[model samples]
Target: MIPPRFAVTEDQIAAVVAEFYTCVRQHPGLGPVFAAHVQDWPAHEAKITRFWKNAILFDRGYDGNPLAVHRAAGDVRIPMFDVWLGLFDSVLRRELPSETAAAWSALVHRIGRGLVFGLGQAEGAPPSLR
Candidate 1:
């Protein structure tokens, strides 16, 4: 089973988030879009930290709506979503144990899918793709 807080320590979460962003920034297909959207990298990092903390561990510290945030980002293409998930999965795999990574992967996959699907719907596409 997954711990509500994901890792045992906040430092572990910080490490995972840092590594994930580092991977995304280096990925050829994803880096440009991320750079464009995340102009304020420090603020973006904090927002993502809160998002993951809330989603994976039920922490109430994060009040941002991730779906709405991505929806407002007009540059979020489908391939960008794919690359984001790929980087997240890859980085988490490198940072966490098998079981922890598995749990985190599942949640990240769902979040990524929802973000993409929300974009599709906003663009008048079918919801079935979700």
Candidate 2:
């Protein structure tokens, strides 16, 4: 039998993104790193909301090169991915149903690993030392 697919809506995605960022902004380690790059929370949240809509719904609303942006940031480290994913998992699980949370978690993990690989830090080397 085929597994049941969760119908993820825009509202759900928006809520998840908002709550996830709230946690990120309050996080001890990840908060400072994000603040250094994202000066405007409202704009950043809007962009990320579009990003998630496009990613999860194929809405074609987002067009930014996330890998390039992260690479240009120049200060992101390998371990930071761990923190980001951990917080993301926490928020998603808390705010969404299990099926939705699992789906988003899988996609986010794939994206995070790809970003780490693109940053040349997949082998656990910090970007600052690379």
Candidate 3:
């Protein structure tokens, strides 16, 4: 395993994941999109937490292709990426320190852009770090 990118902790990552999903489930735009695919909230959150840990901490615990996952979801709209990232960025801001939030938001936005691009979304740009 590689060293973490910054000073964030597992607890922090888990909290953010949980908080983000809580908000996602309530979001008018993103809620239905997620509810259609996510049947087990706990398991999904655990998986996503591991995915983030692998990305942010270099733990190498996650074993899935996010782009493929999103592609397979089919109903995921191009505009959803911006909404998702905006929601995630908001969670980061509320859940983490300024420096750590900015760093993670940068990574999240990069990944969001990749998924949007991989999905053949030709219009609308990913939002910048806020």
Candidate 4:
């Protein structure tokens, strides 16, 4: 059987990121955390855009180590992952078609799990195993 395909354009992804960050900046729980880490919004948004472009479109524009970056940020907590994912899901659902949102949410969920594990935030496993 052929795999399902979702057509996600770069413009749509950019709009999602932009709208998501706007929500993040206003969120009471997440806003302060992101504000502490992100000094310049435009630069951070550009970097994130490159990251999504690379991950979703195979654009090869992003090269930074996200795990290392998150680790260096020094403020990400385990429960924050849930908040981030929830916000991301809401924005994606609002901005994209259902199939496209599902596809992107799945990918982001995997990435969030890995990040949570990598940052030593997961409950059961040591960082080495993760």
Candidate 5:
């Protein structure tokens, strides 16, 4: 596995996930959308923490498909991703060191874009073509 891009611990990642979801739950635009899908906040936070760990630390602890999940939600609009990223950026900047925040922000934005593209083309073509 690749080394981490910056010096960040699992605890830091989990802390960010927890705080970010707290913001998401309180956000007017994001709250309703997420509330529909998330019933157990702590469990969701734990899952997302694993997702970030697997992404940044290559921990291989996360096993969920974000594209399919968002697509299945049917209400996950592309525009909403922009808002989500913005909120996430805010959280990162507030919670991490500048360099770490920038690195993580870049990663998440890339992930967000991929999810948007995947969601957009999901109905247009088969997985083989996409």
Candidate 6:
């Protein structure tokens, strides 16, 4: 039998991206923001594919700035970040096994919070570092 790998494969990345967007589209807090900002989803889909693929694979394929993309998307309100995180966590929990799911859950939460808080800081907002 083959050992389970810690790394997320290309197919897994694709699935995650697709699931993520689907969840985002359905999430009440995040749906409108997504619909408004994500006008061209195919390109965004490819970009997220590259992003997660590189993030998990340590490859050099991803080049887009997530921070910049979110910044350009002025539709995201303060509560949307938490809502997005919840949806992401929900999707992850539903898809992965317990151990792998836990790891990815922690990773996504940490990274999502960091990104949102960092963006807040950069925008001269009050500290969102919680």
**lDDT (Cα atoms) of all candidates against the true structure:** 0.76, 0.85, 0.91, 0.88, 0.91, 0.74
**Models sorted by lDDT, best on top:** 3, 5, 4, 2, 1, 6
- Cα deviation at 74, candidate 2, in Å, is 1.3
TM-score against truth, every candidate: 0.84, 0.86, 0.90, 0.88, 0.93, 0.82
TM-score of 3: 0.90
Task: Quote the RMSD, in angstroms, for model 6.
Answer: 4.1
Could you give candidate 6's per-residue lDDT for residues 1-130 as a string of tens digits?
Answer: 3333354567766887789998788877677777887788888888888887666666668988787677777765556777777788787777767776677777777778777776666575677436
Off by over 4 Å in 5: 124-130
Residues 65-127 of candidate 5 have per-residue lDDT tens digits of 988889999888999999999999999999999999999999999999899888878475865
RMSD of each: 3.1, 5.3, 5.2, 3.9, 2.2, 4.1
> Could you arrange the candidates by TM-score from highest to lowest?
5, 3, 4, 2, 1, 6
Worst 10 residues of 4 by lDDT: 121-130
Pairing residues by index, what is the TM-score of model 4?
Answer: 0.88
Candidate 1 structure quality by residue, lDDT tens digits, 1-130? 3458455356667788988888878878777878888888778888878877777777777887777766777777776777677778888888888888888888888878778778778455556633
Q: What RMSD value applies to candidate 3?
A: 5.2
* lDDT (10s digit) by residue, model 3, range 1-130: 5778888999999999999999999999899999999999999999999999999998877999887788888899888998999999999999999999999999999998788777884335564444
* lDDT tens digits by residue: candidate 4, 40-92: 99989989999998888877779899988888777878789999999999999
The reply for model 3, stretches above 4 Å from the true place, is 121-130
- CA lDDT for candidate 3: 0.91
How does model 6 score by TM-score?
0.82
Candidate 3 residue pairs that clash: none
